[model samples]
Target chain A: DVKVTQSSRYLVKRTGEKVFLECVQDMDHENMFWYRQDPGLGLRLIYFSYDVKMKEKGDIPEGYSVSREKKERFSLILESASTNQTSMYLCASSLQGALDTQYFGPGTRLTVL
Target chain B: TQLLEQSPQFLSIQEGENLTVYCNSSSVFSSLQWYRQEPGEGPVLLVTVVTGGEVKKLKRLTFQFGDARKDSSLHITAAQPGDTGLYLCAGPSNTGKLIFGQGTTLQVKP
Candidate 1:
């Protein structure tokens, strides 16, 4: 079975602080994604990486950046966390195909106070 | 822009009840996937339908893809408390990213 793990399950940060959420997959998938899920908003993509050092912005990428220095790890960075940035962050990975199924990690609930 | 719309944002029912959730889209997709997310956990893929007018069954759950490849439905028979979760449908875009629906939260009481 494919497994995706996140660095933290819950995190708290003060306003204007830098925050990082990490994700790792054991399936050796080539595609990884970051998304923030909110009530009534579903899951909005923040960023995605198709390969090492390759990144793409999704629908809502503001105030967020991503790093994919290795195939198994993907990190989401908040330049300066704000209260509005508090959300449940999810990381997913899929095989190198458009129609492949994405396996998601247990989300990290970030609280920006 | 491609968009997927899901109907009945919420549903609550007793055990042994039947329910169905619908997912619609104006744009066509090559495939659609259904996922069930439990509280505090990431969404888990339940099923994926690729061909138009296709039906697939997994235990008491049935999934159907529309003939136009633009819609899908999930029906659960005799739902139990264990079936309670948020159901989400998504389709891959031309850019290879997925577009997700608003999701349907279902609570099956014992």
Candidate 2:
């Protein structure tokens, strides 16, 4: 089984605070992604990286940014946390070629106070 | 924008019953994927269908891609308690990103 590990299972933060979420994959996959899952909106893509230091915006990338300084680690940053940002965040990684299947981490549930 | 719409947002049936979930889209896709997610966990990919009109089976679960590449379906024969989860369908986006459906939540009672 492929393992994608997220640093935090649950998190809480105050409004206007800067928050960071970390993810690591052991499989050395070339593709990494960050997404926020909501009740009716499903999973909206925030950002994705194809390689280290390479990033692209997804459908909903207004308030988020991503970093991939290392091959195995990907980080998501929130410039300013707000109440509406409270949701489950997921991290996923995939192989480099031919759009291989993506493996996902457990997810981090964030609560902005 | 291209979109994948999943039908039957919620379903509950007996353990022995069978059910089918639909994933429909108006635009053609190069490939389609099905995933099952448990509460508080990320989605696990079940199958990926690339050929139009392709059919793949895994134990009691079956997946079929539409002939036009615009739709797909998942049919579970004789579901069990372990079949309970959120079913999601996704397709490749123009920028190599993935677009996921709203998902179908299934509950199988024993």
Candidate 3:
């Protein structure tokens, strides 16, 4: 079975503070993605990495960045946390193909105050 | 930009009831998938439809893809409390990117 793990299940941060959410996968998949899920809006992709050090912006990439230094690790960075940035963050990994199933982590719920 | 629009954003029904969720898109998709997500967890793949007019069944759940390859639907028969969750539909874009819909939140009261 494929397993994806996130660094924190819950996090709290103050405005303008930097936040980092880490994700690790054991499947050695070539694709990793970061997404923020909000009520009604579903899962909106923030950023995705097809290969180590290769990144692409998704629909809602503002105020979010991602790093992929290793095939098993993908990290999401928020330069300055804002109240509006609070949401459920999910990380997923899949193979290089388009039809590959993405395996996701438990998700990190960040609350900004 | 390719967008998937899901209808019945929220649904509350009693156990043993039946419900259907719709996912529509204007652009054609090479493949479509349905996922179910519970609280605190990421979405889990339920089914994937790749061919036009495809229909797949998994126990009490049925998934159908439109003949145009631009729409899909999920139907649950005799819904159970365990069926309550967020149902999401997604498609693969021309760039090999995944695009998800707004999602449908289903609540099955026992």
Candidate 4:
């Protein structure tokens, strides 16, 4: 079975603090993604990595950056967390195909106070 | 930009009731996927439709892709409380990234 695990299931951070969300997949997928889900807004892509050291900005990438130093790990970094950055962050991974199934982690609910 | 629009943002039904959710798009897609998300969990892939005018069934759930490959629908028969969750539809963009709909939150009461 494919397993995607996040570093944290919940997090609390103060404003202007640096935050990091980590995701690891055991399926050896080549594609990984980060997204923030909000009520009525659905899942909006923040960043994605197709390969090691390769990254692309999604629809809403502001204030966020990604690192893919290895194939199994992807990290999302917030330069300086703000209250508006509080959201449920999800990480997903898929095989190297446009139509492949994306397996997602349980998600991390970040609270920026 | 490729976009997926899901209809009926919310639905509340009793057990044994039938319901359908629709996902529409103006842009053509090579494939579409449906996902079900329970509270506090990430969305899980339920089904994927590739060919136009295709229908697939999984237990009591049925999925249909439009002939134009621009739309899809999910229908549930005799929904139960276990079926309560958020249903999402997604399609791949030209960049290989997925564009997701807002989702339909279905609440089934026992």
The local distance difference test score of each candidate is 0.94, 0.92, 0.92, 0.95
Tens-place lDDT digits, model 2, residues B1-110? 88999999999999999999999999999999999998778999999999999999999999999999999999999999999999999998776678999999999999
Q: Which ranges of candidate 3 are over 4 A from the true structure?
A: none
True-vs-predicted CA distance for residue B102, candidate 1, Å: 0.8
TM-score, chain A, candidate 3 = 0.97
Of the two candidates 3 and 4, the one with more favorable TM-score, higher being better, is: 4
Report the lDDT tens digits of candidate 1 across residue range A1-113. Answer: 99999999999999999999999999999999999999888899999988999999999999999999999999999999999999999999999753578899999999999
Evaluation by DockQ, superior candidate among 2 and 4: 4
Q: List the residue pairs that clash in candidate 4.
A: none
Q: Which ten residues in a row have the lowest lDDT in candidate 2 chain B?
A: B90-99
Query: After superposition, which runs of candidate 1 have C-alpha atoms over 4 Å from their true positions?
Result: none
lDDT of model 1, residue A81: 99
lDDT of 3 by residue, A1-113 (tens): 99999999999999999999999999889999998998878788899988999999988999988889998999999999999999999999998653589899999999999
Give the C-alpha miss distance for residue B95 in model 2, angstroms.
2.5
Query: How much is B50 displaced in model 1, in angstroms?
Result: 1.2
Superior by DockQ: candidate 1 or candidate 2: 1
- The DockQ figures for the candidates are 0.73, 0.67, 0.76, 0.77
Tell how far residue B90 is off in model 1, in angstroms. 0.4
